[model samples]
Target: MEKKNALTAFAALSQPTRLDVFRLLVQVGEAGMSAGEIAAALDVRQNTLSANLSVLLHAGLVRNLREGRSIRYFADTEGLRGLLGYLLRDCCGGRPEICDPLIEDIACHARPTPLDKIGQYPTPEDHT
Candidate 1:
């Protein structure tokens, strides 16, 4: 992420409500959650939640899509990953060992099982 992008994301996360909303979206994943659902889940007023969502949206941390009478919000994972990468790009300098454990944890947590596959599988030959 560029410095400006990182600043924007950081600014958005600086707010308590926006942070809560962003964390909620992250938990929801790609399918996301509707605005009403978010408000209800957080016990936040609709107007307050709306303002928070707007900040996250402006920061490119969340995206909104019209879903019937409601608007659904999803975490912009690419933007988030970019921000995280930018923060960690030079971490631990050349040693790498410090960040290696974090990288391993991320990989372990993100590893997909058969049930997590979103599409069809390929043969072993396709790995090459």
Candidate 2:
């Protein structure tokens, strides 16, 4: 992402509501949530949520699709990747080993596990 675009995204997330909205959408993954659902989950008024969603949309951190009369929102993964890439473009000043652990941590979350296919997470028993 360009510097300006990153700044806009950062500014959008600087707000508590927008940050929460983005995190919720990311958690849901491809199965996005409608505006009503988001409002209810966050316990935010529709009007207030609408404004925050708009800000996130403009900042390229979130995207929405029309679903009948309602709109379903999702985290824009490409935009997120761009911002993350920008941040790590010069990571560790060319000493990759220093950034290896951090990169691994982020990459681990990027990949979906078997439990994701069933829309569930592994329990302690599953791990054993």
TM-score of each: 0.80, 0.82
Q: Which regions of candidate 1 deviate over 4 angstroms? A: 106-116, 119-128
Which portions of model 2 miss their true places by more than 4 Å?
A: 109-128
Clashing pairs in 1: none
Q: Pick the candidate with the highest lDDT.
A: 2
Note the clash tally of each candidate: 0, 0
Per residue, candidate 2 scores C-alpha lDDT tens digits across 1-128 of: 38999999999999999999999998898788889999999999999999898888878888787767788888888889988888789889899999998878766455447455565321111100
lDDT score for candidate 2 against the true structure:
0.82
lDDT of 1 by residue, 1-128 (tens): 38998999999999988898898888767778888999998899999888888878778788777766888788887778988989988789778889888888876366458576584221111100
Q: Could you tell me the lDDT of residue 26 within candidate 1?
A: 83
How high is the CA lDDT of each candidate model? Answer: 0.80, 0.82
RMSD of 1: 8.2
